[model samples]
Target: MYALYYTPGAASLVVHWLLLELDQPHELRAVDIAAREHKDASYLALNPNGVVPTLLVDGQPRYEAAALAMLLADRHGDGAFAPAPADPQRAEYLQWMFNLTATLQAPLRLWWYPGDLQCDDEAVRRGARARFEAACERLDAHLGAHGPYLLGERLSAADFYLTMLMRWSRNLPRPAHDRPHLGALARRMKARPSFAELYRREGLEEWA
Candidate 1:
C-alpha cells in the first residue's frame, strides 16, 4: 500500500488528489508542522527535508510533489494524466510541468513563507508578489490561447498541480481568479470530484 505524509493545503494536496484520481489505495500520515512533528526523527527518516507530501512507494520513501505526480502518471495513468514518450504533445506537457514548478510554485513558496528569504522587508514582499502574478499572467495567457486545461483539451496531472497552487494564491493581491481564463479553468476544475474530495479530506475550506 502507498503511504503519504502531508499537511492540509500543502504541496501534498496535488499528490493526494492524484492518488484519489487514480483510485489508488493509500494511507495518509499527517505530519503536524504546528507541533514540529515533521522535524522529529521518525518523519525525517522518511523525508529529510522535513516537508509535507512524502510518499512511501511500496514502503520506500519518495518526496517532492511534482516528482511524485510524474511518477504516478508514468506508472498508472498510461497517457491519461501525462502524454506518453511518443505522443505528439509530450514535449509541451513536460515543459508545462517543469515550468509550473520552477516559475510558478517556487515563488509562492517564498511568498507564503517569506522568513525563508531571511528578510522581512515590505520591498521583498512586493518582489515576491510581482513574481507570483507575473507567473500567473503567463499561465492566464496560455489558458486563454489554448486552454481551460494545461495540455489544451487534455487534462494532465499538471492541471491538478496548477489548481493546487492557485488555491493557495487566493489571498494574494491578484489571485488566480483575477485572471479571466485561469479563473474559468479553476472554476471548472473545482467542480471535479477529485478536488472536492481533496478539500473534504484535507478540511480546506478556503478557495474551495
Candidate 2:
C-alpha cells in the first residue's frame, strides 16, 4: 500500500486523483499547511522540500506532484494511463507531461505564491500570469487540433496533471476553462467517476 501525505486542493490533488484512478490502496495523511504542520521536522524528513505530496512508495518517500503522477501511472496503469516504452505515442506522451509540469505548473507556483520571488508581489503575479496564459493558449490550440486528451483521444497521466492545473485557474482573470477546447477537455475529465471521488476526498467544491 502507498502512503500519501497531502493537502487538500493543492498540487497533491493530481497524485491523490491518480491513486483513485489506479484503484490503488493508499493512506492519506493530511498535512495542515495552514498550521505549518508540513514544515515540522517529521514531515521534512519525509520530504525535505516541506511540501504536500510526500508519497511513500514501498517504504521510500518521494515528492514532486508531476513526477509522482508519472511514476504511479508507469508503475500501475497497465498501459492505459501511459504508453509503453516502445509505443509510438510514447514520445508525445512524455512531451505533454513535461510541458504541463515545466511550462504550466512552474509559473502557477509563482502566481499562487508571489512572495517566493522576494520582490513586488503584484508585478511578479502579472509576469507569472502572462506566462501561464501563453502556455494555456498553446495547450488550448493543441487540444483544439489534436485532443480530447493531450495524447489525442486516449487519456494519459498528462491529462490528470493538466486537469489539476486547469482547476488552479478557476479564479484567474482568464481562466483556463474559458478556452473552448480546454473547457471541453476539463468537462470530459471531470466527468470521470474518479474525479468526483477526488473532489469529495479532498473536500474541494469550487470547481466541482
Candidate 3:
C-alpha cells in the first residue's frame, strides 16, 4: 500500500486522484502547510522539498508531483492512462507531459509565490501570468486542432495534470478555462467519477 503526504487541493490532488482512478489501496497523511508541519524534521526526512504530494512507493519516499503521476499511471493504469512504450503515441504523450510540467506548471509557481524571487511581486506575477497564458493559448489551439483529449481520443495522465493546472487558474484575470478548447477539456476531465471522489476526499468545492 502507498502512503501519500498531501494537502487538500494542492499538487497532491493529481496524485490522490490517480490513486482513486486506478483504485489503488493507499493512505493519506495530511500536511498542515499553514502550521509549518511540512517543514518539520520528520516530514523533511520523507521529502526534503517540504512540498505536498510526497508519496511512499513500496515503503520508499518519492516526490515530484509530475513524476509521481506518470509513475502511478504507468504502473497501475494497465495501458489505459498511459501509452505503451512501443506505441507511436508514446512520444506525443511524453511531450505533452513534459510541456505541462515544465512549460505550464513552472510559471504557476512564480504566479502563486512571486516573493520567492525577492523581486517586486507584481512584476513577477505579471511576467509569470503572461507566460502562463501564452502556454495556455498554444495548448488551446493544439486541442482545437487535434483533441477531445491531449493525445487525440485517449485520456492520459497528462490530461489529469492539465486539469489540475487549469483549476489553479480559476482566480486568474483570464482563467485557462476561458479558452474554449481548454474549458471543454476541463469539463470533460472534471466529469469523471474519480474527480468527484477526489473533491469529496480533498474537501474541495470551489472549482466544482
Best by lDDT: 3
TM-score of each: 0.96, 0.98, 0.99
The models' CA-based lDDT, in order, is 0.88, 0.92, 0.94
Check candidate 2 and list the clashing pairs.
none
lDDT of 3 by residue, 30-67 (tens): 99999999999999999999888899999999999999
- Number of colliding residue pairs in model 2: 0
For candidate 2, write residues 1-208 as lDDT tens digits. Answer: 9999999999999999999999999999999999999999999999999998899999999999989998999999698899999999999998888888888888889988999999999999999999999999999999999987888889899998999999999888998999999999999999999998998888889998
Among all windows of 10 consecutive residues in model 1, the one with the lowest summed lDDT is 117-126
As a whole number from 0 to 100, the lDDT of residue 152 in candidate 3 is 88
Question: Where does candidate 2 stray beyond 4 Å?
Answer: none
Which is the winner by lDDT between candidate 1 and candidate 3?
A: 3
Q: Sort by lDDT, best first.
A: 3, 2, 1
| Leading candidate by TM-score | 3
